[model samples]
Target chain A: MAIPDNQGGKRAADVIVTALEARITSGELENDKPLPPERDLMEEFGTSRTVVREAISSLANRGLIELRPRFRPIVRKPDYGTLLSATGTIVRYLLNEPGGVQNLYQSRVFIERGLVRDAALNATKENISDLKAALLANEKALDHSEEFFRTDIAFHGVLYRIGNNPIFPAMHEGFTSWLSPNWARMTRSDDHNRSVYLDHKAIYDAILERDPARAEEALIAHLSAAWSYVEETF
Target chain B: MAIPDNQGGKRAADVIVTALEARITSGELENDKPLPPERDLMEEFGTSRTVVREAISSLANRGLIELRPRFRPIVRKPDYGTLLSATGTIVRYLLNEPGGVQNLYQSRVFIERGLVRDAALNATKENISDLKAALLANEKALDHSEEFFRTDIAFHGVLYRIGNNPIFPAMHEGFTSWLSPNWARMTRSDDHNRSVYLDHKAIYDAILERDPARAEEALIAHLSAAWSYVEETF
Candidate 1:
């Protein structure tokens, strides 16, 4: 983790970033709340004006906080895009290491299991209806694997929406998109018809019944089998 | 979830970004791999050069890939800084909503328990030794809570390193820092001393014995109690 050096050969920016990051993360400074003015911060942290500006800029670039024109820096809410970018970075880093893919998938399964359970508990009527629509799309595309895959994802998207935690679905979707293309090619050789139908049906039944424990178990079983197939073949 | 617009007015850049993002996450492009030249990708996707360039720059800025001085853009490995940014964003967002603090603490417990479990299983002899050293540091801190807190983090950090996944520790570190400042107030109650020692000892014992199941159980119990306290107080 060799961090790049500062341009002006000063450590003030680095020190301020670290201190401010700790402050923000530790819940000392609440989200959507403003920090002290630049001048105030500079004086308080004993840093130059440039250091203060650079620290704020770095934070903004990372999407951690927003810097308004006149207002002080404030914490920002993360949307799906920020979540995915972060997921992409973590997954990519893990994938580059030796024997990282399997471990990455393992963590994905852990996260997805929890996500679906929450979705089972929290999903609204609208989300359930949308999930049903996506399932229908899946059934209609029985012969079209690509459409089936898209609809399958759309179904999960609904599941994610139902989960009600914005972070869970966004992160899950990012990893799924990363992992799915490989599985898609693998699925082509197998008898995808019966397994896909049954697995997805089990999930739908659990969701419709509002059985979170069952839903989570079914999801784990479904993905475990699917992932096992990928592991065996690919 | 309103995304920032693509620099160009049209939606083509957005489409290209989506497609390229999928490819990058799927490991189709791979870390440090060169992206196709602008002209080549444009012809393949039937999108304009501007669309492709915008997509690439967007991806780079988001930390998905990097734009080099010459030749094609390269897909770089994801790093801790990026994960921290994302985790911080998510935590901050959670903190903004009503009952958000409780929810954030719940998530913290969930993530940290899993991390400790994984860390226990993956820890090496050297990791254990390092962790022991941090524990000694903690003991020496006595009445100095700040030093104890810092060393306490080091103890867990060593465990994160043991998990054999770089991203886990990185993400954990990000969350730890994000949550640290508030921790002092949270941990300063009448019962803090006894509870912290016992819980820390339980985790330490499990790891020392290499009992993954025990380690996980202890971690969950510890976190569950802590979460209850935070929820009630914070």
Candidate 2:
């Protein structure tokens, strides 16, 4: 098939994708329903088998549909898995370029700043306790040395979970997963971990106090300090 | 070949992806070079033709490699295209859920807040003038409704460009593109457009004055006003 000839396949696929995406979003195609067979789609779009196939692939790429080998493709209720893969892919690419990782880090700061602010404004008391528990877990793990950092991450995860939208946690976790390698490379001095723990505590405290500005400030300070350590180490 | 089963294929593809990704990122395999043939990969990984082919598809899906039939797949020096697609994909999904679009909007705020802050701190005189010209374009286009909003968007685009890292602009543009459909639907009264222009001018003036705090505040105010309009209209 001459490997579908990139540009041509992409153009045809884009056409199919736009049509299908509109259908799916407008609820013309119900969620979790199977799409028509390739033969059917080929006839409907008045395109070749290769054109139809490429179009299906493009829709799959956009998380609008799922393509299975033997069965017809289906509309997808896609989730953070798609988000994580995309974020992870570009992040790895960015790590190789100048100021790339820093941009990623800056983006994380931006995301968490907003998340922390929202958590403070909207979190219930139950959510505050969860944050406290996550903080305690970090403190307990600090003695173990090996598991300390993960619980620290878990603390932020808990804070993110306080918001009504689940994507906040998912997005935060995605960046954390991508940044974990370099995270591990940083020198975690006993004092560093201890200080980090305190930073998380202060953030929790700010949220508990229902202080949005303070929560944001604490997060920015916490991230800035951690970033400084990374800079000094690397 | 029974469409390599999903989860099983995913596992196998992941293994291949990890190995090949390491090779590519490590520069053991240079960018733009064709990956080893499927037959070679099959033998190298001790996998079947179906398994190797599926693995290659996953790499291509992640934009790490591009699959070409009848020839070896090639390594991709992937760009913002992949990242933009992925961001757009997930953002579309997020827009349908509760608090989803809000989270996305908040994310944009965080990013631009940082971008504007940096621009004020770091922008060159030339960058400031470019922003001034964009603001003027927005002002001039006000009479012609269609081009007006685009020039308004271009103003932020210019601010994003002031930063050294190009990804800031790419990421902002990606979010803007995804959010634009909704942006277009809003009732842009003459008064609304005039106020928005003033907001942009304030942001520009902040940057020119080298006031990071004012820049961030102006941006937040501008976005907040826009958000309120969207909320009331919808």
> Ten consecutive residues with minimal summed lDDT in candidate 2 chain B?
B1-10
Share of reference contacts kept by candidate 1: 0.13
Candidate 2 per-residue C-alpha lDDT over B20-56 given as tens digits, one digit per residue, 9 for 90 to 100: 8888877888999988878988899988766676566
Specify the highest-lDDT model's number.
2
For residue B192, model 1's alpha carbon misses the true position, in angstroms, by: 1.1
| Candidate 2 segments exceeding 4 Å error | A1-76, A114-127, A186-190, A206-221, A228-234, B1-59, B65-75, B97-100, B117-127, B187-190, B206-217, B228-234
How well does candidate 1 reproduce the true complex, by DockQ? 0.12
Task: List DockQ, one per candidate, in order.
Answer: 0.12, 0.27
* lDDT, candidates in the order shown: 0.66, 0.75
- Report clash pairs, candidate 2: A3-B69
Angstrom error at residue B167, model 2:
3.4
Chain A TM-scores in order: 0.63, 0.72
Which regions of candidate 1 are displaced past 4 Å? A1-81, A85-103, A113-144, A154-164, A187-190, A200-221, A228-234, B1-78, B85-94, B97-100, B115-142, B158-162, B187-191, B204-217, B228-234
Minimum summed lDDT over a 10-residue window in model 1 chain A is located at A1-10
TM-score top scorer:
2
